[model samples]
Target: MRDQTDTGTTEPIPSRLLLGYARVSTDDQDLTNQRAELHEAGCTKIFSEKITGTRRDRPELARMLDHLRPGDIVTVTRLDRLARSTRDLLDIAEHIQSGGAGLRSLAEPWADTTTPAGRMVMTVFAGIAEFERSLIVERTRSGRVAAKARGVKFGPRPTL
Candidate 1:
């Protein structure tokens, strides 16, 4: 929807449309609380899914992304509920931004990209996550080297 201002300038108004996404890892878990929270957050349309976050394919998430338009906002209860890792989160953020939409997490206010401060915080978080991943990789490589020096064999064991 477009709104015209009195200044004779046709500016696209931010859509009040809040789209909510809620996900649970297992079949035993329920989306009731998430759905309720999303509704409370003024989300007129909510998409719920039950699946592991580690999986690369999330049909509901994909559907929601595809459904978003300019001025739309995507809300989730928590950051983890939206993505499994920093890389994944950044990828999702890119998609949302490219679509001219924003993303917000109820539990993590700093993740709200619609605000300048939130964007800064999210950038810092991304950097920290990347650093942590690098450290992990370095430590893993060091451990492998040490094991090799100790004559530890790599790969599958031979059958007797």
Candidate 2:
């Protein structure tokens, strides 16, 4: 039997399980809304925690990642709830993909990795972001070189 996903696209879902991830930055923040949203999205189980997204050592995230099995689908209310940055998201997504799991972002439809089109979009985005980073580094290096040529010294201003 073909399973249907929460996206309502009837796109031939292959996963046997749906898991959700919800996160907040602080104890003062509530996970109620995110939990409810995830439930509405048809997640059978949800992993949540209150921790700053800046730290890459989130325990709950790691736990959820480890809990993944083949043909499992991970749903998130938003991509930001899952990762701190695009690179972080891509890395996590790659890990999930490597384990035969898929990722779907409720807010960002294009970020879904369950379809060929979505995977292509993510791959292209990764390449573009890398190229942009390279260009930025090149420009910064050139600027530094030009500044050095003009005798603009870098580093500390020297002892008083």
Candidate 3:
């Protein structure tokens, strides 16, 4: 009689787990739609939370990241739900990649990190987002300068 380990390697097959992450900016927003989409996409596990994406300390997101493993894929309904800025997205992507896991966005097909083309697209998107932020900052600074020249006080008004 041949033992199972004698016929093949002792290591078991690595399962490809799809982990979903869903978020809402505020308590009033519902995660139902995101959850439904993730479920339909075949996510075996899901992590969700209601918090501003700008905050650095997101417990659910942290938990999801910690739970990730090799051969796992982190799925999000949209890019905005996962991150508030390009830097944040890049950081999250780095963490996912470091763990040997992949990232995928349902709304943005090009944001997937499992393929070479997808990785290139994500880099391009990050650059675009950064450029857009810089433009907004420059415009805001110009507006501030114009307002200052017009003698508009920016601080709190004097006592009534």
Strongest candidate by TM-score: 1
Task: Return the lDDT, model 3, position 149.
Answer: 100
Taking the candidates one at a time, how many backbone clashes does each contain?
A: 0, 0, 0
Q: Per-residue error at 93 for model 1, in Å?
A: 2.3
Ranking by TM-score: 1, 2, 3
In terms of lDDT, model 1 sits at 0.92
Whole-model Cα lDDT of every candidate shown, in order: 0.92, 0.92, 0.92
RMSD of each: 3.0, 6.1, 6.0
Better model by TM-score: candidate 1 vs candidate 2? 1
- lDDT score of residue 52 within candidate 2: 98
What TM-score does model 1 achieve against the real structure?
0.82
lDDT of 2 by residue, 108-138 (tens): 9988899998899889978987888899899
Order of models, best lDDT first:
1, 3, 2
lDDT tens readout by residue for model 3, 1-160: 2235765756665687999999999999999999999999999999999999989999999999999999899999999999988878988998999999999999999899998998998788778878998999999999999999999889998998
Give the Cα error of residue 45 in candidate 2, in Å: 2.1
For candidate 3, list the clashing residue pairs, or say none: none
Task: Encode model 1's per-residue lDDT on 32-135: one tens digit a residue.
Answer: 99999999999999988999999999999999999999979999999899999888998899799889888999998889999999888878877888899899
Write down the TM-score of every candidate: 0.82, 0.80, 0.72
Tell how far residue 5 is off in model 3, in angstroms: 19
